[model samples]
Target: MQLAIGISACLLGQKVRYDGGHKASEFCLSQLQPYVRYQAVCPENAIGLGTPRPAIRLMKKTQGDIHLVQVSDASIDHTDAMHQFTEQALPAMSALAGFIVCAKSPSCGMERVRLFNEQGHQLGKAGVGLFTRQLMQRYPWLPVEEDGRLHDPMLWENFITRIFACHDYQQLCREGFSVGALVAFHSRYKFLVMAHSPSAYRELGRLVAQAKLFEPEELKQRYLQDLMHALKQACSRKTHANVLQHLQGFFKKHLSSKERQELSSLIDRFRLGHLPLMAPITLLLHHLSRFEHPYLAAQTYLQPFPEALGLRG
Candidate 1:
């Protein structure tokens, strides 16, 4: 099934911006669109703010509260309307695997958006967008990224990995919650979690070990919260090398001295930034193909997303 992803309407090439222009993402349109279904939304427009509507800004009051108001008139507040819109929109959004938002927007920016005081004095860029803030608070596990941040290779790869993992979990839910299914899901992700966070991997292992002790619903919620939290950590080259080494150990009995040495060298080169991650991973996969181990073969770490994205490079 195509993963369902939520996106800011403007980012999806809809002309719903305050100036009636779209901030279309070429990557989203050309590369990702084929793999997933997008549910586009323009919160401002959904609240009856028409195309070419007056621009809005986040204004902080003396009471230490932020409000979305017209750029020209602070008295013209739309905070209530935006909140209502978000409340209504969140239920349907529960099924989304991820969300892509416009950066620096009063309604959609993920972080570091400009802020103003009641008198319009510039405040530091510390305020989150009202709508995006709520979206995140409601779905803490959902992978949310701003359009600009998606340009960074590591961040892009991380976000894509997360959404694919989330989609898999959603499928597990649809298949009905069972202790065996939960254990299997965690087993597939074992190496992936280790790559991101060794500590989290351990924590998740413990949770999975105790899966049957808790209610099915409780176990699902707790496992997802911890799983998503672990994946959010940045996977450094050092961490990747560690995980790769652990994976290489699986082939110790099968690989000759020359094959083992070659694999180790490739991993070292990757750790030293001389090669992309795909180099070592490709060789390991080739070895796995030659010698089948069901556990190693089932790991999602080896092929987290479609290889066509070439994200590891």
Candidate 2:
């Protein structure tokens, strides 16, 4: 299925910035564009700003209020215009599985955009871009990423994984929401949830167990909210190691002593940061090829994204 992703038009190489220059990302253009579809937008341009026009900045007011106004003169406010654009843009963006925003932009930055006081003193990168803040508030469960953050391997993989999962979940909703479908979906994500947050795994299991108590709509909302929140927690080396060890348990009866020793050693090395995560996972996949562990083989954590993406490697 094609996953529709919202992207800052400038990052997608669209000439929509105030300077008439785009902040294009080669990785995004070359690697990611092929896997997912795009819905590029420029909030500034959406607010009737012309190319090569005046630059804007987020100005801070008393009581920590922030406003989007002209960088040269804060008297010229565009906050309401941007808000109106976001409201009008929501319907078109309702189908998007994810969003990739330009970093540190006054209109689209996801976080830490520069803030200025009324007197022109710098506050810090503590403000979220107005349009992006509204977008996220409107769709709290959508996976959002910055073009700059996509440079990091882990963050890139996590972002892609989330969007893919969100797409799948939304598709399931379109088909129908049955308790059985929810169970199957949760089953696939078992190890993934564990690797990210074990507590979430337990909580999700309990919620699924009692799924019948809530209405279908209520259950979908509650379960998806918790699931997305769990996925938001970055999976650390320790947590990854724990999940790897859990996978190792499935092959205990199938693997020889030598194979077990080799696997354990690899896991130890990965846990110690001596190797990338691809090492132990590759070995596990190799073992699964010969071994018949259906449960372990079905876990999405092992292959979250397309192998051609080579995110783990």
Candidate 3:
């Protein structure tokens, strides 16, 4: 099945913004739209706020007390209504692999949204959007990103990697849960976990080792939470180089001195930032195809997402 993703309606070119204009993302529209199914949401619109409605802002009433209110008139609060809508909407969104939310929106921003004091003074950017906060609190494992942050290549790649991984796990769950299947899933993602965090890699290994002790539901929740948390760490060039070298060990017996030197050179060049990640990865994949190592072939690290996305470059 194609992966399902939750996205802000405006990002999908829907004119659902407060001003009756859309914050359409070309990347989401032209590039990512083809690969996955999108579930578009407009929280403000869902809560009976009509098009061209009065804009809203998050106002801090006291410590741990914030309200979503009209920007021009603070007394018109929508926090309760937004909460009610989110409580109703999120249950249906449990199947989504990821979410893309508009940045700096009072209703949908993921982080650093503008906050206001009672006197109308700027309280700096420290608030999370009302709807998004609940969405995260309910489903901490789901991959969520702000639309603007996707412009950064590293963040973009990381988010894509996460959603694909999430979808893989979701598929595994749908196939039915088993300890052996869980182990196989972890085996496929072993190198990927190591690339992001060596410590998490080891921890996850122990978790899977003791999987039989926990109930199946508990095991699924714990494994997914830990796995998603580990993936959130960005893999550095240094880390990628290390993983590449580890992968090189698999082909050591199959390669000639010349072939080994060539692969090592490509990895070294990539580590020094002279080449994109795809350079060494391509070489590794080529070697894997020729050598036919079942372990290496099973790994998702080799091709995390659809190659057509060209995200590695």
Candidate 4:
């Protein structure tokens, strides 16, 4: 899958700032690099703010109005400039399935950024960065996260998984649906959903079963929406565990006793915290692939892009 991901330029180790420093994210650049197509951007710099320029801050008026203002001179309203930069860049970012922003910058912060009163006293928590807010508003389904959150293995995996799933959904969006294809797609994401919500698997199966009643276009739209929503809602760990347990159902007819035992052991190890969920999932997918069944072979879930993100353009 050719997935586009927007990244904070500094995080990608680009020295495109006034301070001549980069806040490079090693994991994102090294680990995720192979899997996604990155479009690194720096809104402030891209908006013609020269390096060494006065820093910008979110400021609040006495009337409770908040605005991103210049720290060096309170008189400057840089909102229009930032907005224009975002608008001009929209076309470039349209293909992105997700984004990773620096945690707290006036131009890219995703949440909990500081806002100050006119007197320069810290007031309270404020909204997201100018560019990040606009991006989310435009593409509500795009998976977005802060660089700091990537340190947590679960969240990191979730973020990456969502992006790739979105890519899968994009393919599904174009080609429409098939019962077998849907099942195979679900199979690939079994462990991920299991980590979030178990009951969702049953619900997804129901959707696929009922799909025959609708036209291909209608079914495609409806099922894709449900599929993506289920994934979004199942992002919690408890929800995922539930989905994982239910996935074992698909293997009932396909696996030998020893294979099932090995997979079961892996699942138990994962549940006991002795192994990563991916360990068990790897085994399940391996066996799933061994099936000579055509439906199983057509499953995009099994090979939803390898470790390479393909972003180096």
Error of 2 at 214 (Å): 1.5
What is candidate 3's lDDT per residue for 1-313, written digit by digit as tens? Answer: 8999999999988999988999999879987989899999999999999998998999999675999999889999998999999999999999999999999998899999999999899999999999899999999999999999999988999999999999999999999989999999999999999999989999999999999999999999999999999999999889889899999999999999999999999999999999999999999999988989999999888899989998887
lDDT of each: 0.94, 0.90, 0.94, 0.72
TM-score of 2: 0.95
Order by lDDT, highest first: 3, 1, 2, 4
lDDT of 4 by residue, 195-310 (tens): 44557666776777776677777766566556555556535434434544555667879888987788777777776677765676677667766765554445433343464542
Off by over 4 Å in 1: none
Q: Which of the two candidates, 3 or 4, achieves a greater TM-score against the reference?
A: 3
Off by over 4 Å in 3: none
Model 2 lDDT per residue over 202-265, tens place = 9999999999999999999888778888888889889999999999998998889999999999
Error of 1 at 278 (Å): 1.1
Ranking by TM-score: 1, 3, 2, 4
Model 3 TM-score, all chains together: 0.98
Worst 10 residues of 3 by lDDT: 62-71
RMSD list, candidates in order: 0.9, 1.5, 1.0, 4.7
